[model samples]
Target: MEDGLVRSISSGLSQKGVRDHNERLLLSLIQRHGALPGSDLARIANLSPPTVSAILRRLESDGLLERGDPVRGKVGKPSIPMRLAPDGVYSYGLKIGRRSAELVLIDFCGDTRHQRQLNYDIPLPDTIFDFVGAAVSEISGALSPEAVARICGFGVAAPFGLWNWPNTSDESDAAFQSWKDVDLRVRTADISGLPVTLMNDATAACQAEHMFGRGKEFRDYAYFFIGAFIGGGVVLNNSVFEGPQGNAGALGSLRTVGPNGESMQLVDMASIHQLELRLREVDLDPRQLWTDPDSWTSLSRYVDPWLGQTAQELAKAALSTCSVIDFEAILIDGAFPPAIREELVGRVRRYMATQDTRGLIPPRIEAGSIGAKARSVGAASQPVGTQFML
Candidate 1:
């Protein structure tokens, strides 16, 4: 035993876990295709006809799956199709950012049924916990009793080591030091009396894109999410490629040159924070960018510098990432307005064209449809994904 040669009774939910896994596999396929015949489900799931039938029957009885309009043109009796009943399940997601907190509820179809948000300077842990508690309670209380009972769980998305952020940023305060050791998931779950899961804000946003965005069209890509700071994630093949410690696509830390030719992290030149800092120099109310994006359309003089810097850094990161891995597309999404996102991505694309990139395959660069809610939607989608998908 001292030498580490050990034997023990190992235990897990062996039998039930397999059944659950199989059920999720079937459901995921149906969700992807919209609907499928029992025979098709059997073939796709690699299960026998009888086994597929049994699972479908069980799911139908549970109100999670149901018979769709029958395919009547077949030679045999019309083959019945099955599809998901969106009301069968629900989930809650929370995104805590440096500027605001957002809570959203999604149904089986990934549509937000209700949402709540607040914008304020991020405060101490106690204040945050209270806001989360009240937000969860409000959303849950607003749901019908039956719908409330159908909730799968809650998922949280926030930057990792956020409390230690002040050390490097101007926003830092000594009070935030208390967050260094807090277990946010456990604490939030404890107060809400519900299960909870946590993920890096960027990773969660990537998951949302993988499940609901251009991922529906491509199997691999790099995702860059812009907010107070730029962040990103990589999807390899059909899954999120969280390498080693899960910072695989952390584009915020990409090495780049600033306007002054000084070396800097990409976030320093390519994020909303940088844009705000530029605006602050002229005494403009930077919050106007968040509360009213339309006004920015007239401020090209102030925005052009930030745009040029961001475009260069983003192109560099994309080229660097493509050199190591093959991707069908590079997606850019952000908390900024739709017009802002589109223009930024376009500038990045045009800038990339001028760079002396040879032997490196270029992929289609596009905007992410998930937009501002990517993190929250992706966060909530995780619990549903783990519980009901393979």
Candidate 2:
């Protein structure tokens, strides 16, 4: 009797271990492939058919996943797919930019259910923190307390040098007066009461692209985000290339020659903010340019010359970068709407098609799939992605 009881206890512990391992594997598979069939999960997770069946049953019982109807294929039995339950978990993401903050709520499957944007005029650090907290509260209030309790965490895509302000010498500190000595992570976490994962806006945007957009096809690529700043992120072997001190792909600092032989940083040449200012100078409101077809058509003619100049600088940067990293592609994504993006991509592609680089493949240039919300959406995935860390 004593031996039998010991054997039963050992079996129970072994089963628990198996369950835990399968749970993690299942979640990772869902994250990677979105929704997949049980057979595919079994193959990806390397679990036997029986084990996969048992695990899926247990997971469904726990409300972590739901099984859909069997899908019929050409030559095989209909296979039922399993998906992460929409209500199983929640994540909040906040993208903090120079002039605006975007808040997004995502489910375990990386689906955005709610999003809001808050604009400010040179917001102080305190106000930024308050705004993020209020956004979180607003999102949380929409759900039940029980559902809110299932929230995984929050991710913040903050400005790249937010924490380095104080160390930039007393003179530089005074120059960036509002940003100097701000502890964004600690203060924001205190207000939100959730574990915060902070990353540069461009880095977060790249992460979003890698997981859900065009970069999903390549293991290595460079993602350039042109918004208020020309930001960038590098993916090496399907992971973010976070350099020492977590500043790997700050591409905005790359200096290139602009139109009329003037030197300017890539940020100055490519950022939407600069384009907006130029539009305003021409007595055209950028908001109208974005929405009205006639305004866009007129704006396109003005933008083409500037875009050609920007494309030249971008090509120079890409050539230099490709010589070093040999990335599969260099993707350009911006806060510009789809129509504008298509126009820019068309011009960039035309330029790139003509350039000849020796002994290296010319990197493909394409518009970002996630559009303007890439950073916020990428931020939403951070918490859930980190949970899979060993």
TM-score of each: 0.91, 0.84
User: How does candidate 1 fare on TM-score?
Assistant: 0.91
lDDT by residue (67-180, candidate 2, tens digit) is 777799999788888888877778888898755788899887677999988775454677777778787888888989988987888888876665442222566455457666
Model 1 segments more than 4 A misplaced: 1-15, 166-171
lDDT of 1: 0.81
Q: In the order shown, what is each candidate's alpha-carbon RMSD? A: 5.4, 5.6
Q: For model 2, what is the error of residue 353's alpha carbon versus the real structure, in angstroms, after optimal superposition?
A: 2.0
Tell me how many clashing residue pairs each candidate has: 1, 0
Query: Candidates' lDDT values, in order?
Result: 0.81, 0.75
* Worst 10 contiguous positions by lDDT, candidate 2: 1-10
